[model samples]
Target: MSEPTTGPAGAAFDDFVAARSTALWRSAFLLTGDRHKAEDLLQAALVKTWRRWDRIGHGSSRSHETAEAYVRRALATTYTDWWRRRWRGELPTGELPERAGDVDEAARAEVRHDVLTALAALPRGQRAVLVLRYFDDLTEQQTADALGVSVGTVKSQASRAMTALRSSPALTDRFGDAA
Candidate 1:
């Protein structure tokens, strides 16, 4: 699709992306647990949001807020859609392809991997809830709005996700005595 690059709509869209893409990318990475998948997810959500930009941009004085919410909601729904379709084009292996050069970096990478592995084990709804509520620092109401779920669902999912994370072997194996 052709994007508007010269008009007010184009400027606003570009500005929004520039301002928020990094934060949005972090949310996407937390959601997907993989860098490439997160990039794909963010791109797809942005494209979807861009398609509706005219309507989103023209209707309100709070157009920026509206556009942000729309983009966030799009990201959440698109992720859910992709999960439901079960698109598993890549498989996890038992070993890292390359070792970290430094011991400190290796330790950090291991911790990050374990955390990601634990997060990846969660059901999509719970994972999404945790990512939105904790990782993205969104409120329960905001998370619910983004996920198209009720506030209660968000709370319950967050509770369950935390419980699951606490018990996940990927985490407990590394930090068993600390908890």
Candidate 2:
């Protein structure tokens, strides 16, 4: 009997991570809208992907794509689960929280922040759709697969998300007539 080979698979996993980690992290950050949360989200997704790496990495022509799809799916599902769980424990308070730090109006980063803020205001599924579709450039079917939803769901979410962003005063100001 032949022993199972771990060396090539491990190397392939490593290569996949090295090539795709940054892009995946960026998607996680867009989904989370917070750097700390993004890091945690990405780490969780990576751990889940690593656990299933061998199975995902051994396919035919689509092995690399399969691995990426698995990781992306993990990120989307984990973020949705985390958001639900986090909100479940929050106590509703009548008092308004402290304001965030003042932003410099002249800085482009502030405008970018405004766009992100608008993005964060979206529902979790819509936000995931935007990230998977626009940020990661996944096709509608791919986005649907990643989120474990039907293609119709992906279309509706993307449409609603775009409408929300376009109507958002913050984003409208950032993009002006372009929005």
Measured by lDDT, the strongest candidate is 1
**Candidate 2 lDDT tens digits, 15-91:** 77788889999999999887778999989998888787766755354887898899999999999999888854554
Instruction: List, residue by residue over 1-179, the lDDT tens digit for candidate 1.
Output: 55565688888888888878998999889888878989999999999988878778743458877877887888888998988898567877665344647777778888888998999999989999999899888899999999999999999999999999999999989999463
Model 2 whole-model lDDT (C-alpha atoms): 0.84
RMSD (Å) per prediction: 2.8, 5.3
State the displacement of the C-alpha of residue 122, model 2, in Å, after optimal TM-score superposition: 0.5
List clashing residue pairs in candidate 2: none
All candidates' TM-scores? 0.88, 0.83
Q: Quote the lDDT for 22 in model 1.
A: 93
lDDT of 1: 0.86
